[model samples]
Target: MAASSGRFESAKSIEERKEQTRIARAEVLRQAKANFEKEERWKELKRLRGEDTWMLPDVNEQIEQFSKAIAMAFSRKPT
Candidate 1:
């Protein structure tokens, strides 16, 4: 009977630990999502105010412009 009681106690402890871990992970995810939304809101506000928001340029466009500039520079032979 004592062995059965011990098993039951261990099972309960395991369940409690699992529940705690789940709660902690959920809280962390919630905080991360909130932070991301806040940042997006700030960017939107800046946009509405005609302020430049930091954003990455399109990689393909940048590459095309860079290639053109390099070609133009090379075409002009050193005087």
Candidate 2:
């Protein structure tokens, strides 16, 4: 019974630590995004210039497409 209780405490501590790290990572990503907008770096990029900006493609979907294209290209045998 004592050993089981000790294992439970350790498991709880590990979960708490993981939750703390997850929150910290989310905060850092939020700050980085805010800094980018504050600097207007995206505005200077010509490709994004004069765009409605409100309408944007899903980033994850775009990345998935890119990954699939790369995989298809690499899977072909060299002549």
Candidate 3:
């Protein structure tokens, strides 16, 4: 049993559509790979700089406070 809706597409058109989809997928993959590589390079550069920008000033102040607390703890004699 066949239902004739009178709409048809050639095999060549199907192949062309498949090829276009494949190309689009390849491009998306390439872009993702490029982004990953760029991020890796950025991290490497930051690592080489020996610090992660030291964070913001308030963050630095908190770190200093923690350090002071730790130092004070160590200085206290054990009961």
Candidate 4:
């Protein structure tokens, strides 16, 4: 009975560690995309108003893709 209890505790600890890693990774991705969006929007708005400037649509696409990836990762959690 004691051995079984120890094994159970070890397994529970591993599960918890995995959860923490997932949460941290998600937050990092969210922050990175947010920063990119802030800068991109400023440039895009300027370009839209016919300013003599340029914008990278590829960055916009990456922001969209990263957002989706974060959402999917969170959704897979064993709530």
Which predicted model would earn the best TM-score?
Answer: 3
Candidate 1 per-residue lDDT, tens place, 36-73, comes to 99999998998887576343557656887999999999
Q: Give the lowest summed-lDDT range of ten residues in model 1.
A: 52-61
Candidate with more favorable, higher TM-score: 1 or 2: 1
lDDT preference between candidates 3 and 4, better one = 3
Worst 10 residues of 2 by lDDT: 46-55
Ranking by lDDT: 3, 1, 4, 2
The lDDT of model 1 is: 0.85
Expressed as tens digits, the lDDT of each residue in 1-79 for candidate 3 is: 2436656788899999999999999999999999999999999998788566568868888999999999999999999
Query: 1-79 in candidate 4: lDDT tens per residue?
Result: 7776663457789899999999999999999999999999988997788573344668767888999999999989696
Model 4, residue 61: displacement in angstroms? 28
Please provide TM-scores, in order, for all candidate models, with all chains considered together: 0.55, 0.40, 0.60, 0.48
**In lDDT terms, which candidate is top?**
3
Question: Clash pairs of candidate 3?
Answer: none
**True-vs-predicted CA distance for residue 43, candidate 1, Å:** 0.5
Itemize residue pairs with steric clashes in candidate 4: none
Superposition error at 22 for model 1 (Å): 0.4
- Against the correct fold, how does model 1 do in TM-score? 0.55
- Which residue runs of candidate 1 sit more than 4 Å off their true CA positions? 1-9, 53-79
Kindly report which residue stretches of model 3 are placed more than 4 angstroms away from their true locations once superposed: 1-3, 53-79
